[model samples]
Target: MKAVAGRMKRWRNSLRLRLLAGTLVWIVVAVLAAGWGLSSLFNKHVSRQFDAELGTHLDQLAANLVFDEAQTLRLRAPLSDPRLARPLSGLYWQVDRMGAAGEPETVALLRSRSLWDAVLAVPPDALADGEMHVHHVRGPNDEPLRMIEQVLRPAEYPDQALRLIVAATEDLISEPVARFNDLLGFALGALSLGLIGAVVVQVRTAWMPLERLREGLAQVHDGRNAAIEGRFPSEIQPLVDEFNGVLARNAEIVVRARTQAGNLAHAIKTPLAVLANAANRDDSALARVVVEQVALAQLQVDHHLARARAAAAVQIPGQRTAIRPVMEALVRVMERVHVERGVQITVGDFPETTAFRGETQDLQEMLGNLLDNAYKWASSRVDVKVAARNGDLVVTVEDDGRGLDASVREIVLERGVRTDEQRPGSGLGLAIVRDLALLYGGDIALDASPRGGLRASLRLPRA
Candidate 1:
C-alpha cells in the first residue's frame, strides 16, 4: 500500500497533470460563458425582429379595414398574398375594439386560426397609448406565442380607438433561435473539449523531459550514476545545467581534497617517523609508549587520506569500465604479495559477457583490497569468482586458511574497527572496500567458505 501511494503521488505531482488540468478548467469556464452570452443575445435580437415584422403586418391590416361604400368595417387583402399560404406561417394579426370607453374588448378581425379561439394575452406591465412591448403569451391553439400591439386610428373616426395586434407564434420566432442555440451549444462544447485536449497534449509533451530529469536525479542520489544528460524545455534547462555544474564542482572539490590530504600525509609522515625513531631509542621506556601512541595517530591519518584519495577519482557521463581487467591486475599483484607464503590463488572463469560496472581504477582498488586480505590469511589455495546475475555482479573470494569466527567477521567490515590484538595492519583495508562498495550502491559481507575457510562476497549493481 505504501508503494502504491508513492506511485500515485509521483503521477499527481507531475507538471503535466497540473498544467493540463488548469488549462481545461480555464477553457471550459471561458468558452461556456461566451456561448451562454451569445445564446441570450440571439434570443433578444430575434424577439425584437419578430415583433417589428408583426407590427408591419398589423399596419397593413388596419389600412385595409375600410368601409366599402357601406360604413361597415371590412378587411382588404389580396387574394394572391404570399404570406397567407405559408405552412406554419410566421405572420399573424388581430384587431380588437371597444364599443365605448371602459367597455370590454371585442375582436374585430384575425388573419389566422393559429390563435384558435383564445385571445393574445400581453404582459400586465405593458404600457398603453402608442407603446410597443414584447410579450410571451398563450395563443388559440394553446401553443406558446410572441406578439406585439399597436393602436390603430382611422382618419375618419379619430376620436374612436382601435387596437391593432400583430403576432407570430413564439414557436415560429423561437424555432430558429432554438436551432441556433443548439448549434452554438454543440460548437462551444466541441471547442472546449478540443482546447482541453490541446492543453493535455502541450503539457504532456512539455513535461516529459522534466520527468526524465527527475528520474536521473533519483539515480544520482541513490549513488547509481555520476551524471545525467538530455535536452530540456526552455523553462527548466537552467536547472539541468545548474545540476550538472554542481556535479562538476563537487568532483573537482573531491579531487582537491584528495590532493591536499595526500600532501598533508606526505609532509607529516617523515617528521612523525623521525620523532618515533628518537622516542624508540634504547632505555627510553616512557618515550617508547609515546612513540606507539604517535604511530597509532599516524595510522589514522593514513587511512583517512586513503579514503579521500579513493573518493577523489571521478567519472564523467557515458563512460563505463569493466571489472575483469582490474581483477586480473589485482590477482597479479596479490600473487606477488603472497608468493613467499606458498599460497595458491585460483581465479574463476568470467566470460566477457559477465562484467561489473565501475571505473577500472576504482574496481581495482576494491577488489585488490579484498583479495589482499584473503591471500594474507589463507594457508593454501584461495578461490575467486566474478560473475553477473540478475543485473548484479557477484564477486566471491574464499581461503583455506583459518576461517573467521562469526564475532570477528562482524567487526571486520565496520568503519574504524580493528582486531583486538592489532593484526599486521590497522584493519582498515576491508573498511575501505566497504566504503567503496557503498559509494557504488553495493555491499560486501563475510561468511563461511565452501572449503571450510572464510568467504568474502561483494554484490554490486550493473550500470
Candidate 2:
C-alpha cells in the first residue's frame, strides 16, 4: 500500500504526466462524441433515402392500380423495379379491398410475385384516403420490412375502396448504416492517435527550457559554476535573472561582513597590545591580573571575529578548494611554528582531487586550528590524513602526546576551556574549529587516537 501511494504521489508531482493525462482524456471524449454524432447523422440520412425509395414505389403502384367491371382489383401497369416480380426478392407490393367504411379487416385482392404465397403482416391503423403511412412489419420468412401503405377509392366504383402497400427488407437501411459506422470508427481512432502524438511532442517541446534551467542550476549548486548561464525562453528568463541576482547579492554580503570583521579586529588589537605592554612593566599582583584580563579580551575578540567571518562566508555558493594542498601547506606552517618542540608532522597519502565545498580561507582557518593544537600537544609526531567518504571530505589529525580523558574531551571543545593552564596558548582552538566546521555545514569530533594523543576528525561537504 505504501509503495502504491508513493507511486501515486510521484505521478501527481510530475508536470508531464498531468499534462498528458488531461490531454488524453479530452482526446478520448472528443473522439467518442464525434463518432457518435457522425454515426447517428449517417443512419438518419440513409433511413430517409430508404423511406423515399419505398414511397416512390408505393406511388407507382397506386397510380397504376384500378378495378375492372367485375369488381376485381388490378394494376394497369407494372412497377418499374424488377424485384417486384422476383419471388421473395425483399421488395413487394399488395392490394387489399375493405369490407366496410370503418372495418379494420381487409381481403387481399392482388400481390406481387415477390410475396411468394406469404403476406406482409402490417399492423392495423387508421389510414386516410390517398395518404401514405409508413410502418415496420414482418414480411416473407419473418424478415423485418419497412412498409408504406395508402388507402384509395376508385372513381369508376366509388363504393369499393382499396389499400396498396409497398415494402422492402430493413436491411436496405441497416446495412449501409453499419458500414458507415465501422469506417467512421476506424477513421476517428486514427485521428485520435495522431492528436495524442501531437500533444506529447508539444508538451516535451514546451518543457525543454525548464529542463535546461534545472541542469544549469545544478551546475551552480555543485560549485562548477559561479552563476547559472544560458539563454532561456521569455517565460523562464525572469526566473533565471532573479536567481542570478540573488547569488550576486549574497556574495556581496559575505564580502561586506568579512571586511567589517577585519576592520573591527584591527581597531581592537592596538589597544590590547598597549595594555599588555603597560601591565608587563610591574611585577605586582594588580599588574599580573591586568595582563591576564587583556590577553583574555584579545582571545575573545579573535574568536568572535573568526565566527563572524565564517558565518557570513558560508552563505555564498560556488566555492571549492582541494584538500591535499591545503592540508600539506598547513602541516608545513605548523611544523615551522612548533620547530623548538621537535614535533614531527606527517601527512598520509590522499587523492589530489579530494575537495572541500567551501572557501579556501575558511578551510584553512578550521584545519589550521586543528593542526596547531595537535602540534602543540604532540610528544614526538603528529599524523594527518585526508579522504573523501560518503560525499564528504573527512580529515583526521592525531598526535603522539598523552591523549585527553573521555570526560575532558567534550569539555575542551567548549569556548575558553583549558585542560591544563601550563599549556602556552588560549583554550579556544578546538572551540573555534568546532564553530567554523559547523558554519560550513560540517563538524569536528575529538576521540582517543591510536597514536595515544587526541584525534580530531573534521567532516565537510565534498565538491
Candidate 3:
C-alpha cells in the first residue's frame, strides 16, 4: 500500500502522466458528443421514413375511395398491404366526413379491418383540403401511434368532404433507433480504448530522449564520464551541449584556483626560509623571537595552503578513490614509520569496492593524519575499518592508547589546540583532517575508542 501511494505521488508529479490524462479526458468527451450526434441524426431519419410510409398509405386510400349512385362514400378496392387487413396489427387507416359549413361536428365514414371494431382517437383539428398533418394518437389496441391525416372533397361528389388518416405504432421507429444507439455506444467505447492506448505509446515514445539524458547525467555524477555522452534529438542536443559547457567552465575554475594556491605557497615559503636562515646565523634574544615568529608564520601558511588546495579539489568533478587501496597503503607506511614503537596496525572489515568521491590526495591527507595520530598515541595496537553507511563512506581509526577527556574532544579539533603539548606536533593534524572532510561535503569527529584510545571517525561522500 505504501508503494502504491508512492507511485501515485510520482504520477501526480509527472508531466507525462498529466498530459496523457488530459488527452484521454478530451477523447472521452469527444467520443460521447459524436455518438450522441449520430444517434440523434439516425433517429430523425427513421422518423422521416416512417412518416413517408404513412403518407403513401394515405394517398392510396384517397385514390381508392369512391361514392356509389346513392352518394354514399366507399373504397373501390382494399389496400394492397396485407397488414392492413389484419385486426389490431398496429397499422391502420380511417376515413371521416367533415361537417358542412357553419357546423362543428364530424362523422366516421370507413376504417381498415385492422381497427378490429375500434376507432383511432385522432384530435379534432381543422385540416384544409388536400393538406396533411401529423399527430400522436391512440390506436385500436390503445397503443401509441404516429398518424398522418389529410382532408379532401371527392371529385365525383363535391358536396361530401372526407378525412383520411394512416398510422403505425410508435415502437416501429423507437425499436430500430434504440438498437442503433446500443451499437453506436459499443463502437465508441472500443474507439476510446484504442485512442487511450495510442496516447500512452506516443507519450512514452516522445519522452524517451529525456530518460536517456537522465541516465547520462547519472553517469557523470558517479564519476563514470566527464560529460554527457550519446547522440540526441535536435531539440534536446542543445541542452546537453549547454550542460557540457557549464561543466567545462567549472573544471577550468578549479584548475585555476589550484594553480594560484600553489603559486601563493611557493611565493610565501621563500621569504620564510630566508628569515629562518638569518635567525639561525645570530644567537641573540631578538634572533630567538624571530625564529619563534617564523615558525608561527610557517604553520599559518601551511594551514591556509592545505585549506585552499582542498577547497579547489572539492569543486573538481569525477574524482573517485578506492577505499581499500588507500587504507592499505596508509597502514603499511604507518606501521613502518612506527616500527620501533612495536605498534601493530591491522585492518578490519574494509570493503574493496567502497570509494570516496574526492581526490586521492585529499583522501590520503585525511586518513593519513588520523592514522598517524592513532599510531603515535597507541601503546600496542591500532585498528582501521572502512564501510559505507547512509550514502557516506566512514573510515574509523582506533588505537589502544590513553584516550583524552570527553570535555576536550571538541577543543582538540580546533587549530593550534593540542591535548598534550609534550607531543612533537604543531597541533594542526586533526584540524586539517576536519577541514578537508568538510570541504568534500563530509565531516570528521573524535570519540572514545572501545579499544581504550581515541576513535577518529571520518565520513566522506561515497561513489
TM-scores, all models, native as reference: 0.66, 0.75, 0.77
Which lDDT tens digits does candidate 2 get at residues 145-220? 9988888888887777677889999999889988898899889989999999999999999989989998898788
lDDT for residue 299 in candidate 1, whole number 0-100: 73
Q: lDDT tens digits, residues 286-347, model 3?
A: 99999989998998898888888889877766888988888889888987888899998888
List the RMSD of every prediction in angstroms: 6.3, 5.0, 4.6
The TM-score of candidate 2 is 0.75
Candidate ranking under TM-score, highest first, comes to 3, 2, 1
How many clashes in candidate 2? 0
Candidate 2 residue pairs that clash: none
| Tens-digit lDDT string for candidate 1 (1-463) | 9999997898799666666667777898899789889988998898777666676766667667775666666677632336544544554556666345523265555444434445565443424556666566766566676777766557877766666676666776678998999999898888887887777787777767878898888677434567767777788889988989989888777667867888899898888888888887855778978798888878777666656665564333332567767777888888887788888888888786555555666677678888888887888888998877777888998998778889888788976676645446667778888887777668899999879888999987665
What's each prediction's clash count?
1, 0, 0
Q: Each candidate's lDDT (Cα)?
A: 0.73, 0.87, 0.89
